[model samples]
Each structure stands twice: as C-alpha cells, then as structure tokens.
Target: MNQESNNDQASAMNTEQVSDQSLSRRLKLALGLSLFAVMAVILLWLSSIKNIQNLEHDLAIKLDTFNEKNMQSLALAKNADTRSAEIAARAEILEEKYTESFDQQAALKALYQELANNREERMLSDVEQLLVIANQQLQLAGNIKPALLALQAADTRLQGFDSQKAVQLRKSINQDIQRLQNLPLADLTSISLKLGNLSQRVDQLALVSDRHPNSAQNKIAPDTSNNPWRKLTQEIWQDIKGMIRIERIDRPELPLLTQEQTFFLRENIKLHLLTARIALLRHDEVTYKSDLAAAQSAISLHFDGRESLTQNTLLEIKALTSNHISTELPDIEQSLRLLNLYKLSFVPALAREPKSKRLP
Candidate 1:
C-alpha cells in the first residue's frame, strides 16, 4: 500500500507541473503579442504624425505657388488692359488719318476731272493767244526777246499736245523765233541813260569867252623925292594922261554879256539838252537827230571848246547820233495765221461733237 501511494503522488506532481508550464507558456505568448501590438501602435502613430506634417508642408507650398501665380496673372491682365487702351487710341488716330486721306483723294479726283474737261480747248486757246501776243509785241513794242519768248511758249504748248497737226504751226513758230534771234537789238535804255547823264552835266559846262586879256599891275611911282616941285610936276603929267589916254589891246574884242543874257543863254542850253533827251526816249529818229545837232552846235558855240570834258562829251554825242534807232524786225504773221487756221478747224470740229462726247 505504501509503494502504491508514493507512485501515485509522483504521477500527480508531474501532471501538475506540466499543466503550470503550459499555462506559463501561454502567458508568455500573450505578453509577447501585447508588446508587439504596443510597438506596432507606436510605429503606426509616428508614421501617421509624419504623414500629417508632410501634408501640411505640401499645402503651404501649394498655397504660396497659387498666390504667386495669381499675382502674376493679375499683373499680366493689367498690362493687357493698358495695351488695349493704347491700341484703341492708335486705332482712332489711324482712322482719322484714313478719313483725311480719303477726303483729299476725293478733292484731287474732282480737280483732275475739271482739268481734263477743258484741257484740250484751253490749251489750243492759250497757244492762239500766245501767238497773237507775240505778233503784237513784235509789231508794237519792237521787243524781240519778249516776242521770241511768246513764240517759244506757243511752240512748247503745241509740243505738249503731241499732235501731228501742230507740226506746221511749230515749224512756223520756230522759224519766227530764229529770225528774231538773228536780229541785233540796240540797247536803247543805256543810250537814254547816257543822254540823261549828259543833260545833268549841262550845268557844269564853262562859258567860252572870245578873248582873254592879260592882267596889268600898276608900277609903284618912281620914288617921289621929298621935292615938292618935282612931285607936283609928276602929278600934273598923270592928270594930263588920265584925262585923255589911248590904249591898244592885243586880243580880239568880244561884246560883254549882261547878267540877264548870261542867265538866258544857260537856260537855253539846258532846255536844248532836255529836249534832246525827250526825243531820244521817244525813238523819233528825225527829231532826235535835229535836237542832238542843235545841242552840239550850242555847246560848241557857247562852251569852251578846248575843255577836255567838253571834247569827250561832243565825241560821245556824235557817236550816239550815228547809230540807227529804228530797225525793221521780222514779224510772226505766219505763225499767227497758222494758229488761227488750226483754231478755226479744231474749234468747229469740237463744237460739232455731241455734248456726251465732250470731255465734261
């Protein structure tokens, strides 16, 4: 019985120990699982905190970027607004210029049309009038230069027309011009001015005298001695000589002029010079020659002929009188006649045309 109890106790103790070891192992496993859960929870909380911080930082950066982009967009928008206003102003200026240009173009067109309307007839009339004026100048004024100019103007007008019909007229006008060009023209103005100068010098001419006498000086009476009787004798002889004396003059005698006659002579000379100037200006060949001759004769007779100035003036006057004042100039009658015929033919044909076919 004792042995059986001991064995039974041993078995019981082994079973109890096995059961405690199993329970301890289960407690150890549960503690290890709790430690792992606590560590996982701490790790997951740290990761979550870090993720929150990253999200906040990212949000701040995005906000800053958005603000910067928004500010730049605002500035660009403002610049766009300013540029748009400037463009509007420029467009308005351009529009005004366009309007002014259009108006000027319209005025130019009207002016061109008006000019075209009367261009042909007016040109022909101008040419005809020029030819007439040239003829008149040649005939009336004897102005070769102006007549040539008028003829040249007519020729240029004909050439501007570039018509075959104007060829004969141009040829006639050219011939007239050449003829006028070949003629020598006297400088009447210079001659007239010279005459006027001579007239002014008439007052300075010295009067001529037929004879000049040598001046006699009285000799001092021979020293009259203090002798009263001798002085009385000399005085008595002088009184006898003074009462009746006959002196012989060596020079030819000339009649003395009264002051009034001298004045009248000078006035007559001036009058002649003035009359000669007038005749010269009038281009009166007959009166010019006669008056100049009379003036020369008067100057030679009254003025001192030996004076160098007088001799030179007389020579110049003689030279001027030798020139022919009147000259025959070739006329532009041929050109005038040709222009009239052209006008008669051209104007009649233009008049016969229908109104619709006319320029205007």
Candidate 2:
C-alpha cells in the first residue's frame, strides 16, 4: 500500500510539472511576440521623426526664397511708380509747350492780317490825295495841263492793284486824263508877252500935235560971198512961211495939249492897257475886250494915224482883241465820284474775298 501511494504521488507530480512547463512556454511565446511588435513600432517612430526633420529644412529654404522674391517685386513696383511720375510731369510740360506754340501761331497770323490791311489803307489814301489835287487844279486854278498830269499819276498808282473797284477807278481816271489831253491849250504866255512889249513902246509913240511943217525952205544957202541983205530977206520970208503954214488937216481940230496934259493922256492909255492885261489873266473875256478896245480908240484919237509906229500899235491891239481867253473846262466829277465809291465799297469787297485769295 505504501508503495502504491508513493508511486501515485510521483506520477501526479510529474503531470503537474508537465502542465507548468506548457504554461511557461505559452507565456514566453506571447511575451516574445509582444516584444517584437513593440520593437517594430519604435523603428517606425524613428523613421517618421527623420522624415519630419528633412521636411522642416526644405520648408525653411522655401520660405527664404519666397522672401527674396517678395523684396524684388516691391523694388520693381517702386521703380514703376517713379517712372510713371516722371512720365506724368513730362506730359504736362509737353502739353504746355503745345499750348504756347498754338498761341504764337495765332498772334503771328493776326499781325500779318493787320499789316496787309494797313498797306491797303495807305494805298487808298495816296490815291485819294492825288484825286483831290486833280479836282482842285481843274475847278479852282482852271489849269488843264496840271490836272491832266495829276489824273495820270493817280491812274498809275492804282495800276498795281488787281481789285475790280481799283480797275474801275483807274478807268475813270484815264478817261478824265484823255479828255484833258484833247483840250486846246491857251496861248496866254504869248499874249501876255505881246501886251508887255506894247506897253514899253508907249513912250516912243508920236502924238498928232507933234508933227511940224517943212522948214527946209527957211534955211538960207551959206555961200562964200556972205550976203547980209540976202540972209535978212530969207529970215523974214521963213518967219512969214512958218506963221502961215498951208497944211490940209484930214480930221477934226486937233486938241492942243501942254506937256503935262500929254503925259497924263499917255498915262490914261497905259492904265487901259494894264486893265486889259489884268482882265486877260483873270479869264474875264468881256472886260479884256472892252479895255483893249478903249486903249486902241484912245491911241487912234490922240496919236498921229499916219506914223508907222502908231499904225503898228493899232494893228497889235486889234490882234489882241480877237483872242478868246476863256472857254468851258471839263469837270473831274466822274473821277472823284468813282474814287469816293471805291472808298465806300472797299471794306465789303475785302470781306467777301476768300482767305486764300486775300492779298498777302
């Protein structure tokens, strides 16, 4: 019995030992598996940490590059702003210069226009003055030659202009000049010279009472025999012949005048001639003829008609009386009217002309 009990106990113990060994093996295997899983997790954590460090370094470099690019952009933007400001200032200056240039051009154009107008006005004034002189010469002075010259000069002055009114005015002036040229010139200078020569010959004129009978028979022939009785007898006969002169008077009784009376008569004749000369110069035909006739009648009645000098004076007086001193003169009214018309219409014609057609 005892043996059986000990053997049974030993067998149980062996079984318990086997069971303990199996449990320990199972625990050790589970612990080994848990340790291997923990190691793998640690290795994965280490690898993830290294990758995170590399990513941090890359991000820093990228941040620095971005900062540099931002600075360059700011600098470029600043430079662009500066350039825009300068361009704006230059544009303002260019605009001011353009405005000044335009103003200067406008001023120059105005000055040129004013100068042209003044030139035209001056030319018209000169023509008007010439016309006035011509009118005065014709109307007041009665001088055809001077008036004709003045009209010709005015026409020549207007010849430079091409305007229609100027042409018409020139035509009128030329007509006036032609009319004056056709008129007969008076020979006043020749007539006046003849009258002066006649007045100088007045002192030498012989009077009717100045004539004397023949005294040749009263002179005794002075021979070498000196006869006193014959000389006495000849002187007595000469006195008798002188006292009773047989002369046939052709006209009425001659007026016996003293030296003073003869001088006064000659002065009266000269006064008549002087009056005739004044009348001729004054263009008074009636007065000139009447005074000349009076002078001629006085010379014939007071002076000896048979004397050659007296006959010559009478013939000259007759020639002077036949001359016509005064005549109708042509008026310059047509030319003056045309000039006034041109002056009045000048402004309108200038206005109607185109800018391109206006005289420079």
Candidate 3:
C-alpha cells in the first residue's frame, strides 16, 4: 500500500513537471528535475560504497593480528616439543648407564658380606639342615658343568673353615670327591666308596653281635671276644657303607642296586669273615672295635648327606639278625643308632627317588 502511494505521488510530481504553457519552458523544467533525481541517486550510492570499504579495511586489520598471534603460538609449541624430546633421551641414557654401575657396586657389597667371619659362623648352625636342602637342589635338573663349578666354588669359599671340621671334611669328603668325576650319579660317588668299605665292616661287626649278644644278663666270662653289641654295631656300619654303593643304573626302576654294589655287597661279607678270623688271631678286639665304630659314623654321614643313601636292607638285616644277637650288644645298638640318624635321611631320598617312595 505504501509503495503504491509513493508511486502515485511520483507520477503526480512527474505530471506537474510537464505542465506549462510553452513547450520550451516545460522541457527545461522536466530536464532540471531529472538531473536532480539522478544527482540524489548518485550521492546515496556513493555513501553506501564508502561504508562497505571502511568495514572491509577494519576486517583486514583484525585478520592480520589473528595470523600473527597464531604463528607465535605454533613456534612456542614446537620449542616445547623439542626440549621434551631432549630431556627424555637424557633420562634414558642415565638409566641404562648409571643404574648398571650402581647395581654392580651393590653386588660387590653382598660378596664382601659373604666372606665376613661373623656371617660365615652364623650359617653353620643351619648347615646340617641346609645339607639336605642343598642335596635336594643339587638333585634337581642342572647342567653338569654348572654343578661342578658351584661345588668347587663352595670348597674355595669354605677353604678357611674351622680346623676340626676341615680335617674331617678333607680327610673323608675330599678323598671321596677324588672319584666323583668317574661316577654318573655325581652326588653318590663319594658315598659309593664309603659303602664299599662298609660292606666288609658290617660283616665283621656282625661277628661281635653274634658273640656278645645284646640279651646277655652279665659278663659271665670273657668268651675270648668283644661284646655282641660291639660286633653288631661294627657289622651294621660296614654293611651300610656297602649299601650306599648299591645304586641302580636304570635309576627309576625299583630301588637302585648297581653291579658294583652287588659285587661289593656279596664279596664284602666274605671279607668280614676273614677280618674276624684275623682279629681272633691277633687278639686285637680293640682294632676291630675302633674300626667298627668309626665305620659306623662315616657311613652314617654319607646316608645323611648328598648321596641320598638309604638303609632299607639294613633294617631288614636288623630284623633278620634280631634273634641272632642278645639285648646286651651296646656296640650294635650304637651302630644301629647312628645308622638310624642317616636312616631318616631316606625320607627325602625316596620321595625324590626315580622309583622308590619309601622314607630316608
């Protein structure tokens, strides 16, 4: 409605411009009005263009400022990334190098502690307990070279042990060790030698048990012999030594009983008979007595130690020989008692035995 009203007013104004008496006067007035309208249009269009240009200039300045600030932010981020990478690389290098040196020094400190006398002495009280632990561990799967090296290392470290144990260990254990390399079951070889000796010892000692008898009421007469217990103890000692040598090659099949052991066991009993005759001829019950006692202890040690030796057959012998000897046989009781100590060692042995599951 407003646009129509405006159009009507413009038409009326155009009519008035043309209204005149002379054609020349009217033409001049119409031309003046058209020129004025054109001028007004040109001025309005010019003002609009100027406003647009000013707006574009202000926007351009804002864009330039934004681009500059963005560039600075990007450069700072890159610098931070580079510094972080450098710090991380340095930290890794220090961890690899210095940490290794620190650990090496700590290891040296532990070694020094191992050699200290106070520390060494402290370990001895538990040494007997550790013997089985060591034996069990030694029994487990291990490389031969490493096992031998570890054993040698132990010997080297304990080289300065107390004189008493050192003497016995040297005189007995080391002697047995001399034959170790030749044996397949490295742990049992020393005990094998002891067993060999013990077979004869047992047979000979049996004679004493036969003569004196543990059931004897009193010393009725000399009987031209040592006490029965002494003889029995001696015999048991010798038998155990031989038994330790009794190992099976097939290992896991039944209880072990090697060829060497069978041969030693059979022949040794005969040798004991001869030894008894010799004792009778020499009138040297003391020699027999001493040897029998010593043999008992030595054999006991093997059974109780690394050989994982056992006394099953010996217990059978005791049952078999129970009626053969009387109750007065102190020597037999003593030997049996010592053997009993080692007998307990069988528990672990049988548990670990390739075949047997009886106690030690």
**Which candidate comes out best when scored by lDDT?**
2
Q: List model 1 lDDT by residue over 1-360, tens digit each.
A: 878898899888889999999999999999999999999999999999999999999999999999999999999999999999999999999999999999999999998977864686687789988888888777776666677898888878877665555788888888888888877766777777877787778777766753332223222375557898888877777666556645448855445667687778767766766776676555567877787788788788777776777888788789878867666778777777777776676456778788999966
Model 1, runs deviating above 4 Å: 1-117, 120-129, 156-159, 210-283, 345-360
lDDT of 2 by residue, 11-117 (tens): 89998999999999989998998898889888888888888888888888888888898899899989989989999999999899989989988998998888877
Candidate number with the higher lDDT (2 or 3)? 2
Tell me each candidate's TM-score.
0.49, 0.54, 0.23
- Candidate ranking under lDDT, highest first, comes to 2, 1, 3
| Local error of candidate 2 at residue 274 (angstroms) | 2.8
lDDT value for model 1: 0.77
Q: Indicate which candidate wins on TM-score.
A: 2
lDDT of 3: 0.46
What CA root-mean-square deviation does each model show from the true structure?
10.3, 16.7, 28.5
Clashes of each: 0, 0, 31
Weakest lDDT window of 10 consecutive positions for candidate 2: 214-223
Per-residue CA lDDT of model 3 for 1-360, tens digit only, reads 999999999988777766644566777778888898888888878887888788788878888888888888788888888888988998898888789989988987887775664455543423333333333333443223333443344445445666554444333333323433434432223332433544644533322111222224322333346689876766676556555533436634323446576456445454543453344233344543443344344333322222212254344223322221111111112222332343343346546566544535
| Cα lDDT for residue 29, candidate 3 | 78
Scored against the true structure, residue 38 in model 1 reaches a CA lDDT of 91
